[model samples]
Target chain A: MNNERILLVSRPKGTPAMSDFRYEEAAVPELKGDQVLVKTIYLSVDPYMRGRMNDTKSYVPPFELNEVISGGIVGQVVQSLSSDLAEGDFVIGNLPWQKYNVVNDISVRKLDSNIAPLSANLGVLGMTGLTAYFGLLDIGKPQEGETVVVSGAAGAVGTIVGQIAKIKGARVVGIAGSEEKTAYLKNELGFDEVINYKTDNVFEALKAACPGGVDVYFDNVGGEISDAVLRLLNHGARIPVCGQIALYNLEKMDVGPRIQSQLLINSALMKGFIVSDYAAHFEEGAMELAKWLMEGKLSYKENIVEGFENTIDAFLGLFKGENTGKQLVKVAEPENV
Target chain B: MNNERILLVSRPKGTPAMSDFRYEEAAVPELKGDQVLVKTIYLSVDPYMRGRMNDTKSYVPPFELNEVISGGIVGQVVQSLSSDLAEGDFVIGNLPWQKYNVVNDISVRKLDSNIAPLSANLGVLGMTGLTAYFGLLDIGKPQEGETVVVSGAAGAVGTIVGQIAKIKGARVVGIAGSEEKTAYLKNELGFDEVINYKTDNVFEALKAACPGGVDVYFDNVGGEISDAVLRLLNHGARIPVCGQIALYNLEKMDVGPRIQSQLLINSALMKGFIVSDYAAHFEEGAMELAKWLMEGKLSYKENIVEGFENTIDAFLGLFKGENTGKQLVKVAEPENV
Candidate 1:
């Protein structure tokens, strides 16, 4: 079968450009023993992918040059040699940026679409949800009536984080890039206060918003926003750093005001964690998040760009703050649906 | 009785100067109900006192101007009007920088000099010891075979921290400002490695010393030393920030490389703490530390300056890195001794 795929042609110096990726056609080989042939339905474009694009020692290995950029992909099984997976089944796996993939059954998990929308598994009920779940509850540990400040509040993880803090009876304050994004967080997500960081003096706005001082900070976009929040921390404050989208694209080292003294004076705690770090408790986290969704206590949004060709554009748009929620590309639709 | 006291005549802009303190003579008033007149024996000159000197928000309130600068003082009960303490009893309390102080009986704790030397209560067996105990064991929970790096390794708290980490079965590396301090740490304290940050390129030296990577960092000195340590952190490294002596004298805001991204990528934990945070468990910490001391598993040193007139000079020498261990002023000798 003919397969369309995108390969990383060059490493980005700062923000990635279109020339960095090369779209081409390739051939997919026949499935062998215990192997399954899957056609890509939806491909996720996340900020974390940017880290893997750089050749650095991080939690995950960097993407190889002239190779298909790989990430979370939802696909439909067209052919299966393994008894574990059946034809016409929908599954999700960390797969390449390609139209068709030949994989072993262990590489993908079968998904039941009756539980929620197929795309929701890529977002609110998936890695994004779990990232917010464990980072906030396990690390941030927001107490009732305490104030929680969330950066990147309109993004997938940040939206879930703010909602979870609210569910735990905290006063949620969100920091976002645009007025429209901040409005969405306050209006739809029940954020008690929202700061447009692009337009507002973040330090003053945050000080005004958190009158009692910030007790828990869920940091998604680190940099100046984090520095300002560090200054206003209450005694024994907790900061769970899940992402640093603000510094991911920088070509040079990131420099700013040091935080050790502030943390020292406030007696605060800051921890960094990835979703897979809590893989053993994934069932518990996902079940609780799903229950919240079923009870109408949680809300989520997705920015879906149609066609496989827009995947690069969708991924690049994340740095520009163009997406209000989980951003994904629709490579194809389930044939059964 | 005649009392000689030093008062904070003015606040220092950057580094404290002699003009900031005023020494004067005052009369000790008659003891009230349950009050005791205590004569100062040894005065603790700690790095944390620098924070209290500034009129800013911190864990402790700033010292009032034109008033006696109060801190840790070991005194002897000269006259007692209460049953809690008696004449000739050696006691310790947070008291003013005065030769004699009249305080309520509840303010001081009677020290049993038979168990250990009186000065040990101010250095190895007192608040300084407790600070090292809780901050290391609770926050920087170093596991066996891991590399534990300590900054300000020859200081009171840092010395104890290195000893405790060694007791916990971790390999200990100490960073100090002088060759003499590093030699003391390596030769006397049995540190696995010692980095003389004064003469060495700290980043390169640390890299060579910790070939495996730093697992637990007990940071008593922050700034560039911490930045270098942060770069070489192993995954899930723990940092307990007990003090920031490096930035204590800065007149302007401290600017350096932001650490959130590094923390995010490594999944590490950094917590700032004071000894009092674990107040409820003080007895447990003190007991364990005392056991180590009694077993000869721990060793401590103190830089004692004789005479009350040298008290200000002794405190000022801390910023200049003049002391080898716990810095104290011997205001008077014990009558019995």
Candidate 2:
């Protein structure tokens, strides 16, 4: 049988183009001992992936030229050689961006579809969900009645972050690029205020929205939007930096007003973190997130695109502010199910 | 009796000039109930005071125009009507830039001169020491064998910070402007490395000095120097921003490469604080610092400019980086002592 996969053909310059990626087809390898043949159903495309595309040092190593891009993938066990897994079991793992993966059973964790939808295992119950959970609770630490501002509020982590801040009884304010996103955050997500960064003056809008001043800033889109939120931080405010999507595609070093003075005057704290930093406590965080979901205290959205060929488009759409929430590409159906 | 006091006659536009201050004479007031006459002996002149000279908001309130400038002052009780304070008692308080101040006894904390020099109350074992203690141990949290980089490493706080990091068994690198200052840090203070920022290519020197990367950055001088140190941070590094003396006098907003990306990729933390932020635990910090001093694990230096007439000069000299350590003005001799 044939397997289709995407390869990073070239390193992107300023903004990535279609020429940077290439699609290839190869024979599906036979499984070895304890290995399972899993058919990929869905794959996640995130903003942080942009950092891995550049040939520079980051939290994660840069993607090598012409290598298969790997990320969060949800699949079903179509064939198993060991007793640890069986056909029809749904699973999730950090897998290559391909139609099928033949790997050792230990590489993926089996997921119970009864708890939540299988696709959600790639989102709210997965990486994006955990990212929002730990970043908001651990770093942001939004106290009751304290104002919390989140940038990229319409995206995967930002949407979940605002919801979690609201759950913590914080006065939640969100910043996004569209009217639809602002409306969704305010009207649907129970956000106290929402600023459309494309239309409104962010700094002035933030000042008007956060009358008490920002106490926790959950930053996803860094740059000018973060600059505005930072200016309104009260004494002892905390900023949890999860992503700098705004500057991810920039060809040069990003520059702005130095923030140390602002931080100094306000006695504020700014910390950068990845979800894996809380890996030891992921079970605890996931449990709480699941409980919140079960109790209707948490909600999530997914903007899934159909077909494996569209994965590159889905990934590039993140920079253009195209997706509203978790952007995923659905490649195939669960054959066993 | 007459008292000579310095007043902020005008708000400084950029770097403060001597013309911004005025020396005034006033009749000494009588000590009322619980009031004691404090004869200013050793008054501290610090870089943080520069922030107060501006009309803009800061951690401390801006100095009101034509009002007396107040700061850390070590004085002797010359006259007292309060039963709580006795004549000849040494004390430290946020007192005015004056030859004498008649204030309530409760306003000043009595100092034990036998423990250390009375001027030590304004430097090590006092504000600067406590600043270093809390900022380094609490925020910087340097672990044994880790690398600590301190900017303005010859200043009052920086000197103490490097010593404290050393006590923690960390490899300490000090960055200062002059060769003399660097020599003092490396030869006298036992810093692992010293970089004269003015003479050497700081980025290259820091790279050579910190082969393991920086785990803790005690940032006393912010600007380009900090930018260089920031680039060399290890994953999970902590930066305790103590002062921004380098940018304090800028006529316009200081701009630099936005640091969020650096902090993000490394999952680092940067916090800003004043010594007063840890006031609730000041005694605990001061006690530890005092113990270190008594054990010979710590040492301090003070550049005392004689006479009250040189107070403004001593303060302005901080901008010029003329003083090696704690800068103070000796106002008068203790009459009772």
What is the lDDT for A263 in model 2?
95
* Model 1, residue B155: C-alpha shift (Å): 0.8
lDDT by residue (B225-313, candidate 2, tens digit) is: 99999999999999999999989999998999999999999999999999899999999998998898999999988899999999999
DockQ of each: 0.89, 0.93
True contacts kept of 1: 0.86
Poorest 10 consecutive residues of model 1 chain A by lDDT? A328-337
Which pairs of residues collide in model 2? Answer: none
Q: Where is model 2 more than 4 Å wrong at Cα?
A: none
**Could you give the DockQ of candidate 1?**
0.89
Query: Which model scores highest in DockQ?
Result: 2
Q: Which CAPRI level is candidate 2?
A: high
What local lDDT does model 1 show for residue A257? Answer: 92
Candidate fnat values, all? 0.86, 0.92
Residue A235, candidate 1: alpha-carbon lDDT:
96
Name the docking class for model 1: high
Task: Output the worst ten-in-a-row residue range by lDDT, candidate 2 chain A.
Answer: A328-337
Could you tell me the lDDT of residue A139 within candidate 2? 89
